[model samples]
Target: MESEYKHLQIGVRAAQAPKERRVLHRVWKYKLMYLLLLPACIWVFIFDYLPVYGISVAFMDYNFIKGMSGSEWAGLKYFQALFESDMFLTAFKNTLIINMYKMVSGFACPILLALALNEIRVKWFKKTLQTAVYLPRFVSWVVYGGIITLLLSPETGLINKAIEWFGGHPAYLLAEPGYFRFILVVTDAMKEMGWAAIIYIAAIAGLNPEVYEAAVVDGATRFQRILHVTLPGISGTIVVMFILRVGYIMSAGLDQIINLYNPMVLSVGDILDTYIYRVGIEQFNVSLAAAADAIKGIIGLAMVLITNQVAKRINDSGIF
Candidate 1:
């Protein structure tokens, strides 16, 4: 039995030796590339994976002084609290509605912008127009939000002044709950559309020029060429972007909402991120906040997985 075991070990080692040598050879050959990647791997570990350990706080009655080790095990207590809380429910609903609105408008706007830009024959005019649209994305949301507030101001806004000139009542649009989500969706699209169009434009540029020429030779109109050649060429990028957008459905533009929203519009504009900030940072209810955040993460992850599968099935391509 001992002799047979020794023979088996020897055979296994003999088989593994060549594989191990090949791995070592490849590593040595790519040493420079590996070295370049080391910093990125370290950064990901530190910033992304290291925080994963703290997710346990969601299941614990986390105490600052008591620390993680001394905290009481609360199991699903916090998660239950999250579901039961009226504020959380409102935030959850608002998050979904707002993100859906943004997704529907935001997704189409960039594609349309890219297509429109692609059709422009005048280079200088296209560049100037692109710059005008892209400039909004560079502005900080704080400054942008302040600008929005000023524009919507009832007494002194340019919009109000224009309305007054037209013999209309100058209304405070920001304070109205009905208008808050619409403003968020429109502003978000305006800010992001040009920037997001860059990828689609690049994708369009990468399409085969011969295919477009063939379409033109076949008597296809400009719109028909775009439909057949351009759209199909960039469909993969579109699918990947759509999947990523769906993954963040739970996020709902925290920065934009935080800067734009007030007490009056909170009921309509409040999202999970803002709710978590209020509970965790301001109120210091750590466990409950953690649980709510955990739910967001889980939902986002699930959405990504499901969307990736659906995208693959539909388009035969995905981020994966």
Candidate 2:
């Protein structure tokens, strides 16, 4: 019996050795590829992973003179204060409202634009339209904001001039709270719609040409083909992108807001990022800022997980 058991153990070890050797052989074959990836791994480690340690500042007094190691621990003191502050609540509310508006307007615009562009038979016309829309994405928000300011200027702006030509009163669009949110949503969509459509267009391009041919054979009209074939084919990509967008529900375009917003619109336009900058950088309250950031990160992470799970449940397509 002992001899039989010993022989079985030897056989198992012998079988495993070949599998181990194959894994090592494959690794050796791809050694150069792995070497190419080394720099990116190091970069992520230094820039992404290393900075995570600074999250500890949320629980500490975080004095610049004392340093991180020597800083006094406060144990959620800043977090408690943040929760009770009116500014934080206002910023949170504004962030959610603006981001939700952006999600609705900005998210659907790209997909619709891509579908429209795909139907264009004239290559030159299509290319020209794409270029015109995409050009705004490359323009810095600072320059674009200045142009928008000039265009929306009540006195000498083109839009106001046009309004006057049409016998309508010229109003200060940016200063009015009612129009501020709408401007943010529309302007953001316009700036990003073309760039966002590029991904969907690529996804559409990858669809099997035979599928559309079959749809045509089935007597599907152009719109029917788009509805039945193109949309379904790219639904997975749309879902993935939607999940990512959901994760950023807390981030309300700080650069654009900061540039376009003024004291009048701050009540409606102040978001978490801008609020964090004001409190942390301007006021020198490092701990409170860190706490706010930590909360945002945690909420964003939770949103990604929840949305991914929902996507998987619906269609079995998720980022995970």
Candidate 3:
């Protein structure tokens, strides 16, 4: 029996030898690419994975000086507080409402823009239009928000000026709670739609030209071809993008909100991220802030899993 076991072990080792060699050879062949990837790997480890250890702070009464190891365990105290706090609840509600609108509009706008751009036959005109739309994405929210603020200014904004010229009263759009969510959705689309369309455009470009030609030969109109051919061809890309977007449901564009929102609109504009910032960083409620953030992360992960499953069930497609 011992002799047979030893032989089995040896046989397994022999079987693995060539596979191991092939892996090593492939790594050596792609050494340069791996070298380039090293920095990104390190950065992700340092900034992303490393912070995971701090999640423990949420379950403890975190102290700046005492730190995680020395802090007393508080269990679910902060999480309980999150639900009990009116401010946190309000923030959570606003987050959901704003994100829902943004999600729907954001998802559809890019596809529409990509389709529009794809239909342009004139190469120079198409390129110019693409470049013009894509330019806003390169600008930081700080700058873009400032531009939007100027445009919406009650007194001097271009928009208000146009409204005044049209015999309408100029109002402070940003400060109005009713108008705040609309502004966020519109601005988000304007800033991101073009950049987001690039992926869709690429996906559309990769579709079999022959399939499109067949559709044309079948006497399909331009719209009909797009509906039957272009959309189905890019469905996989759409599913992947949708899954990714769903995963980040808790994160509602912090930079844009921070730059654009004011005290007046906090009731309608404050999100989980801003709440965490205020509670954790501003108020120095470390444990409570950590709890909120941890919950946010957990919900985001759950969302990704749920959305992926739904996508798979609907059409046999998902990120996994």
Tens digits of per-residue lDDT for model 2 on 192-291?
9999999999999999999999999999999999999999999999999999999999999988999999999989999999999999999999999999
Error of 1 at 91 (Å): 0.4
Cα-lDDT of candidate 2:
0.95
TM-score of each model, in listed order: 0.91, 0.91, 0.92
How good is model 3 by TM-score?
0.92
The lDDT per prediction is 0.94, 0.95, 0.94
Q: Write the per-residue lDDT of candidate 1 for residues 34-138, one digit (tens) a residue.
A: 999999999999999998888899999999999999999999999998888999999999999999999999999999999999999999999999999999999
RMSD of each: 6.8, 5.4, 5.6
* Cand. 2 TM to true fold: 0.91
In model 3, how large is the Cα lDDT of residue 175? 96
Q: What's the lDDT for residue 75 in model 3?
A: 90
Which has the higher lDDT value, candidate number 1 or candidate number 2?
2
Evaluate model 1: give its lDDT: 0.94
lDDT of 3 by residue, 1-320 (tens): 99999999988986778887878878999999999999999999999999999899889988889888889999999899999999999988888888999999999999999999999999999999999999999999999999999999999999999999999999999999999999999999999999999999999999999998999999999999899999999999999999999988888889999999999999999999899999888999988988999988999999999999999999899989
- Name the weakest run of 10 consecutive residues (lDDT summed) in model 3: 13-22
